[model samples]
Target: MTKIFIIAGEASGDVLGYRLMTALRALRPGLEFSGIGGARMAEAGLVSLFPMQELALMGLAEILPRVLHLKARLRQTVQAIAAQKPDIVLTIDSPGFTLRVLKAVGANGPKRVHYVAPQVWAWRQERVKHFPGLWDELICLLPFEPDFFAPHGLHPVFAGHPVLESGADKGDAARFLARHRLGPEAVPVVLMPGSRVTETKRLLPVFRETLALLAPHVPNLAPVLAAAPGIADAVAAYTANWPHKPVIVRDVQERYDAFAAARAALTKSGTSTLELAMAGVPMAVTYQVNPVSAWFGRRLIKVPHVAMINLLAKRALVPELLQEQCHPEILAATLLHLLRDDEAAAAQRAGYAEALASLHAPEGTPSHAAAKAVLSVLG
Candidate 1:
């Protein structure tokens, strides 16, 4: 039996890996699978070595103290995969963990495939040099990444952004408004602090404060908080004291519906920024990492913009307040500008539409393309 080992350490990577697994199963039935992934990947038949959430962490400073624990887990995972002798080792995102494990496994000369290209385009461009020798192929979600990898002697395939296939719900916005007990005429403002505990802890307080500031001016506004699964309790606890009591939605589909109904959004800068852009929701992106990590990142990272919406547009299409700039008052002012200023909001929405179009795949779906690439490596 052909065996494939895949590793995806966080929520986004888990979703990507799961979709790829489903596509691979359709292409090649009876393929064996094992890996490190989350609930979604487990549902897709991935046998995880550890609970996926165990590795879902962010910020270099936050991760520094846990290095020994992570190293032991990596060794355990690599040894298990080596013993299984999979035909190909496929890793999705989570570069810090995935790439290190890939290097350890590559030492034994196993074929390797990496999905969801790291943000080498943003910073640490030198990391691109490590891929050609570490992995057989790299599958990227962004179109511009292949060119970035070409000059570095690495073959990179643009698999297209997976969010396009998410098939956002297009039902009546009024229905979503009604179901959430909101007035039909109310302008919805969605708040997505983040899907991780670390992100929510760092950003929710600022989001709540922003909401407080905007509540009075935008009387017709109803804030919708999209809480990612497994972090719902944390999100709820964080917002329990807020005076406005924002509406909270849990399911991913429901969250997309919230986006569809939203006139504006205040979101943490990440993949969700890409989703919001696709939904054509004008937004203000904010992010806050550990103070020390933020300090170090500012010195090392070369990118001028942090939000994926602005990064993909190759300009400041959406307002981004990151690190020290992620103050609640600034976030409030940026969000209010989008909510109240028609011209500015329309311009941002138009830019988002263009950025969304730029991400569409040339042929087939990204999941299919990624699966095909993995199968080729397995062969």
Candidate 2:
């Protein structure tokens, strides 16, 4: 029986890690899995060494105080890898922590496989330079990523975006509207603040204010908040004091239905942008970080846009409001424009199709492709 150690630091990575673990298990039924992951990975049968949320942090400034703790965790992880002597050590995303772990594991440790290549093409192009010494192989989500890493001597396999594999992209808008007791003419706007606690705390107030601003202009507008499963109650509590209580969507089917029913979306810039795009929902993306973190990020980030959909499309297909631009009024105005202007919204929807076409895998699904790549190293 082969032993596999996996690490996934954030919610998105946890989801991807869970899917990958299930697929890997399908192929090798007796595979022993252990890792640092969240609820999803634990549910998928991993006996985690530590709570993955401890490493869920983002931004350099935000992590400053926790540096000592993270250093200790990193050492503990390296020691775990050595003691376990797993056939493979797979890390999904969280390049900041994962790369350091890989470096400590060094050239002679277990076969190091990194699922989801770091966004070197977007920023810190120098990251690919470390691949030869660190990772034995890379599994990428985007179709265009392999070529980007190949020139740098990194082996990259396009596993497609996990969103395409998830049936969540498909929806029944009419049924959704009826289920929610919403009228046919109600203009629903999907509000995805984020899955993280910090993200929700920072963005929900802005989203609440935006909803209030839109009330006068769009009397029939329905604000739908798509909350991630574990944090549903927290999301509810956070928005309880708002002037308008958003129609909170919890279940997977309901969330997708909400996405389909949306005339537009105001979402945090991340993986959800791709989900909204997959649902053909035109969106205005925004995000905020500590001012110091934002200032440092601006210097390192090479891309023109922060939204993954826009980045992949190689153009600003959707409006992006970041840092200083992520004001309630600006976000509301951008979303309002998308909702009211048919031509602009249609254009953005068309851009989604074009961008999505580029993202789809040429052959198998994401999990399958990723499993095949991982299995190859074992052989």
Candidate 3:
């Protein structure tokens, strides 16, 4: 039996890892999987070494205090994978934790594969040079990512964007709206703070404040908050005191339906932006970080825009309010512009159409593509 060790440190990565594992199982039924992941991966037969949350810390500043703990976890993961002697060690997103663990595993000359290539295209292009020595195969979700790695002597295969298959169920939308007591004429605004507690704490207040500001101008503004799997209680507590009650939906199917029906969205900057684009929802992105970390990021990052919509378009297709600019007034203004202006909304939708086309897989499913890359390296 062929054994594979897979590590995915957060919610999105967990989802992606599970899908890939499922695809690999289809291709090779006797494959064995073991490593660190969340509920989804566990359901897909991954025996996690530790709870995925231990390695799911966000932002440089948020992770600073936990560095020692994270280092210990990475060392433990490396040792576990090394002892298992899997045919291939596949590390998913969470570059901070995954890369450090990869370095340790690679030092011993282990066969390894890296999924979802880091945003070397955005900044730190130099890091591409190190992958050839660290990972035997690179499987990327974005089409352009492979070209970036090619120059560095690493041949990367483009796996389709995992979000392409995350289609929303129309029937679920009506049922969810009825269950939440949302009227048919109500224009719902979806608020997706983030999948982690730290991001929820940092972003929910600003999102709430933005809704408060937009309430009078856009009456019948029904806001629905999607509670990320692990942090439902945290999200509920954060919204408990809000002047306006927002319906919290937990099911992924219903959440996507909410995205499909939403008039507009105010989301944290990440894969959610890609999802919003996939749903053709006009949105404004906002993000905040600790003061020191923000200052450091400003100096080191070279990207012109933070939102994936803008990055993929090679221009500002969606407004990104980051750090100081992530104030409620600014977010409301940007969202209002998108919601109220028909022409602007149409233009943004066109950009979304283009982004969607760019993400389509050429030959096979992304998970299948990724599994093939892993197997090739293992052989």
Stretches of candidate 1 off by over 4 Å are: 169-172
Please give me the total number of clashing residue pairs in predicted model 1.
0
lDDT of 2: 0.86
Please provide, for model 1 over 1-379, each residue's C-alpha lDDT reduced to its tens digit, 9 standing for 90 to 100.
7788889988888888889989999999988899898878888877789888878889887788889999899999989987999888899999999999888887466689989888977877777777777788889888888998878766788878888877553535666787888877788999988877788888888877888898888988798998877688878887888887888888777878888899999888888898887777888888889988877777778788888878788899988888888987888888888888999988988898777777766678879888888888777
Q: lDDT per residue, candidate 3, 56-115, as tens digits?
A: 777777898898988898789888987888878889988888887788887465688889
Residue 263 in model 1: lDDT? 90
Please report how far candidate 1 places residue 133 from its true position, in Å. Answer: 1.5
- The collision pairs in model 1 are none
- Weakest lDDT window of 10 consecutive positions for candidate 2: 356-365
**Model 2 regions more than 4 Å off:** none
Would you list the C-alpha lDDT of every candidate in the order shown?
Answer: 0.84, 0.86, 0.83
* Residue lDDT tens for model 2, 1-379: 8999999998889989988989888887899998798888889988888878788777777688899999999999999999989999999999989989988998788888999889888888886776787889989998778889888888888878887766657988998999989998898999998877677878888888988998889989889999877688999888888787889998778988888788999889888988888888889989998888888788889888889999878899988899888898898899889888999988988888888777666667778778888999888
How well does each candidate superpose onto the true structure, as a TM-score?
0.95, 0.94, 0.95
Q: lDDT score, residue 326, model 3?
A: 91
Candidate 2's clash total is 0
Clashes of each: 0, 0, 0
Ranking of candidates on lDDT, top first: 2, 1, 3
